[model samples]
Target: MQNRGWLVFTLGVVGTLLALIGIFTVMEGQGLIQPRTIGLIFFFGTVALYAVVGLMVSARKVSDYYVAGRDIPAFYNGMAGAANWMSAASVIGMAGTIYLLGYDGLAYIMGWTGGYVLLALLIAPYVRKMRAYTVPDFMATRYEGNVARSVSVFAALAMNIVYLIPQFMGVGMIASRFLGLPFAWGVFVALAVILLTTFSGGMRGVTWVSVAQYLILLVAYLVPLVILSVRLTGNPIPWLAYGKALEQIDAYEVVHGMTRYVQPFTNMSRLNTLGLIFCLMVGTVGLPHVLTRFYTVKSVRDSRISVGWCLLFIILVYISAPAKAALVRNDIYQNLVGTPINQLPAWMDTWGKQGLVKVNDINGDGVLQFNELTLHADMIVVGAPEIAGMPYTVSSLIGAGGMAAAVSTSLGLLMVLAAGVAHDIYKKMINPNASEGVVLFWSRAVLVIVAVLCALAALTRPALIVQMVAWAFSIAAASFFPAVFLGIWWRRANAQGAVAGMITGLVVTIGYIILSHFYKIQFFGILTINAGLFGVPANFLVTYIVSMLTAEPSKEVQELVTELRFPRATRLIGEEG
Candidate 1:
């Protein structure tokens, strides 16, 4: 009910923002205004709007702060989930990979989108039925051991921080590029927006803000594609127009005597592709921030329906990403491939200044050959509007969308991490008699501290955006997925087995990733495979064998699992000693 008013206000504000941006574009194009100035206005304007909303819906009660009082409807929860799941990696990274790798890049789309199906079937319903505020709470309660909960809390914090810092960096980078500000200043802006929105309302505010973000980002991504599609093939649907563009690209590649862009296994091996897919699919079910979304809905039924809606929203962008990539690739080949370096389009000059696109006369031929140019894939989506000769405002919109994706996911991850500390460990183990006011105060305090720390870490310039994400998912898949899946379905899964499984999966995956990424070492050549590949199986084997070797979970724990597994019978909330 509270969201209805917020929804109406958001619609009006977003519409006004879009209209103003269009006007600014017209002015800049006609030489009446500067595009960078317009960009600054739009960037700060949108972020300020979110800050205002956060303050407006700020919560007082612990229930409202933590899980929005568990009152969110199925549809809105789905939208928020979609927004939370589709982080900067999904918005910027996927299209960029598709642009660079062609057929090989489709793996990201397949793995990420397909993971929702697994969430719908395997995890969402049962997790929601548990009625816990955080994943560690469920893991601790289900296993009947605070030790298990403590392990989960540490794991959740590690994974989420690794994930969260990159998003913070992304937000900073996007703002810096668009407004021509220092990267640190852009990071400060991001920190301000995050603290304002998240600190004000907690989950209650974040859920609605996520809905607004999803709408803004989806529109920003789609508008340019539709325009480019119509220009290339007289079709407004980008994916459908991709068919026409693909034929043209293939012909152009033949004329240029280049490798076909549509060929499979061109960028990565078949084994790596399939391994990546498996990691992503299994990884989705385990992400603390993502799985936490199921807790916001009112019932188990809502949780299931929400996953369906989340997938629907995600597919809209997933299917379009490849098509957008193909069109951009074709556009470059058709127009810029044979042009002399100095005579290339303005976009080339613009992005080249940023080091995103490089051109060299490798053969001393003075012309920009297809093979002579190297592009960073992140440019594909961010530079697409400019590549298509759209107004500068469209490019600005893309930047805003990228920021939205980064901040929304960061907000969600930050919340779960705070809950892991304040609720799971602090209240549960450190001070069981802590009052609601004390718990709420510490939770908000932890939330703000986490945001600030992540923002500062973002300035440290960590790993590549997409690579850091892969590590996070691999960790989740290796550590959390096996324990979560087996604990609910296998009655013999004792607390000892669950804890041991988590440790095995986590150590194997993280250790392999460290060796492969940092030391460039591939132990026995197996570490070169997806890190989750080894970790997941190790978890299953160790957990199953250990549980079989040990005693079953206590009768009460077994009965609790049965109740959660089948929602037709009894209900439990909070937890029993």
Candidate 2:
């Protein structure tokens, strides 16, 4: 691990950067600078900061490009992991989902956090000890077959591309809404920022930039909650203020005849809640971007510590999310429920411009009835400052924070995709003797290509961003979790079994999702979101049944598994065969 000096220095740099942005924001509000310019400067300037750092720390060697030379300290890796884990879904969509579904949405929180616990206990140490550069690296070595590697690589790429679409699209959406830029410009900016930083530094660059992003996003997310909490309950701490705020909300609900917002399980079935939580938890363990972080640390012990820190940082954000949802829901009801449509707050009008908040009088009444107001799940975070009457400066900070969350995750997934192509596919299977420089060059090339492809996809304005994010998780859980778990723990697991299991899991999960999502066909009247439930069991059964029916693994494959079972006995890339 490096000295603690860098930690202190980095914090100082972040503090200075934020202080300058804050000052510029005030000046803009006071007519010293153009509002749009300040927004652009602050938002993209943060990206520039990351780009400079990434260029400075970027890898010259294949090892560094792939895994940051395996020298990242646990603390820094933890921060990076948190930033990676909390994608646009967590930052922008989580609060919105909670606001829409009330207690039922808490499943996302429980499942995501609980999955980290599972990661720490069941997965991280072994993967770190195995010392694989990519998820497929571990898969190929353990299963002792090129076929296993190819399947794992394809799954990683598919899941990652699906994941990246929403994040990049979020960048464009946030930029358009917050900076008054066109959506394409927003996406171009995101692509440029990602290419400049991640393409330059690779995993090393992503690691440090993610640490900076964690700071920006958390502060941006927490600031509005703190101010609103003080206004609602005379406390700045959001969690502490939630109970009192809920009381006020309940009373407001009674006055307005609102039931779904206050009642638990009113918006979704409890079975769906269980299903969502289960999928997200297992999905967390299965996610390549999250698991890849473990491979970047200095030691297996550091990897474990990194998970602990990840949970700590993630929990802080997760707990505050419910507070944001409750406060925003209450604020809207108390302030806008009975106001005349013509006299509503400017924030409502501005947000309405984006079609995020809809106000209509279904009964032909002039008053804005509670039932007449419709809030999209995203408005809770994006329009939060305006809802609370905060300054445009704070709103700008929130926009930047949203960008941080989106860009940080996009950078990580882009790396995963690039590595999947350049390292896993090209060098491993195509040119086993490829030079390190050639591999690094292809990795950088793929990074730019992916950014462009994802940008084009983002321009389609996919309505399924959040749903796709969940789909990514569910797919990852179904396809990778069982194979990975069995490969590490069960010696009888063979290449044939893994191949069958992964293919079955992917088909089952995707098949169920297509039928339910496109056709609304419920299985045996089960309308709940249990696609993962069907896929996961089928995976285990097929893998076990197929492996037993086929030949057992070679002695070398068994030896590799035994080696991975202990941290100290293993070396990096412990491929016995």
Candidate 3:
């Protein structure tokens, strides 16, 4: 890498960190402000300002904006990409969602992580070899027809819209409930923040902003668990407390004295355990946004480091969550449940009125059951200060962390969505002769349009973060995983086969989800299944069958594939270097 690259990347990161400091120092509504409002504003405001700084520093070069001049380091790139891939959804939503779902939620964790392996082993290095700016660039180069181009465009669109919704919805949920503000206002605030980062700087600005997001997300999740774990289990490490947590979830019926909607997941059978983990882990490799992270890495090795760093950061929250969930559940049962209704913790009454928590005390037991608390699980973090008797200031800081995590991720997704529109479509397929400046203009322009669309989707909001995220993962698994993996390892793969496979897999997976979710099917006097259940096999089978039947790839595509598989050629590499 050249000094020019180093100067740009270092300057970029330091600038972002300074901006974060400045933003934090200036925060005014620290006490009266709800977590949602402060989080949404500060995160968006601070990062947007970073983007503006980044744009000013590098606006002279289109290449700098697109890929940081292609000199991003393996280690830092790994960190940046990991943070980019993980968002508010992972930091704020995953644990709470997992706590409620138990073993079922492991599927999301596995699916998200697994998608990156597919990127490293199958698609990323080869895509890098293609020397293209985005994922669609690979599709365009691989397939002979506009068919590949069209699929790439639609895939990027599908991945972006579905992924963006949860982010907006979450911000809306946090703002309206936490701040006592209208949900639409939360959506608008987040939109403004996202626009500041993406519209100003494109990928370069977004990258540094994500680094700040990662810090906020990790700290917010880690601190509470550390405090709870040491107090409850006499063990500072929460990941090791899975047995205790599972035992808690298992004993909910006894603890809360409510036997309804309480199943002993701890006693899950062997087959059930295998099925749950397998589905989640294998599905991880299929997510589009995760794969997109690899595009930012400078090399395949760097891509691998990014995944390793990602897993390291991800495990911080993943391991602690079950323990925290269990501890919180126990705390609720021991101190709050079975108490006089008004005697419940002050935090409960406060957040409960905000719809963050609710109590029926249906058994006349004067206790809130584990089942009774699932609806309120999302607010546990925000309510932790009052529940555990922490200082009010600390609680506000956590809120700030959560909002920052969410905004940073939304910004990353926002940038990716913009690139798909501008670089993938406007410059690549639509105008082959488009100048670098035209590309830069279209990229930022598209960034603005997508930001508005995502904010609107947040208005309706979804039922929960996990559901929307799961749906998106299922879509990616069916459409991308099979095709990309086969393309890399198999010799027989061709444009016809790859195209056939993607369409077949995507349609089967997405169509089934829509049908099963929206309406059930009637077939020959027998009712059959939810969509993802049947869709997975359909995607693989189509990819395999189509690849087998279609002619092998063109000579040029095959040679490119060979080159991608081999060590970098000194002659060619030096020439480029």
Alpha carbon lDDT of each predicted model: 0.84, 0.84, 0.62
**Tens-place lDDT digits, model 1, residues 1-577:** 7668656865875688678867887798789988887777768877887788777888878878789988887777888888898888889888889888778778788888888888888888998888888888888888887989999988887788878888988888898897678989988888888877788888988988888888788888888889889886788878777988899999988877877889987787777777888888888989988888988888888889989998888898889899888988888888878888778888888899989988888998889888899889788899888888888888888888888899899888888888889899899999999998888778878888878888899899778788788778888888889888887777788888889999999888888888888889975444333788889999999988888898888888888888878755676667786
Residue pairs in steric clash, candidate 2? 58-201
Tens-digit per-residue lDDT, 45-88, candidate 3: 54455566555545456666666666655555655566666656
Candidate 1 lDDT (Cα, 0 to 1):
0.84
Deviating ranges (above 4 Å) for candidate 1 = 1-10, 255-257, 523-529, 571-577
Q: Is candidate 2 or candidate 3 better by lDDT?
A: 2
| Poorest stretch of ten by lDDT in candidate 1 | 522-531
lDDT of 3 at 374: 37
What is the clash count of model 3?
A: 8
Candidate 2: list runs displaced more than 4 Å.
Answer: 25-29, 254-257, 260-262, 524-530, 570-577
* Backbone clashes, each candidate: 0, 1, 8
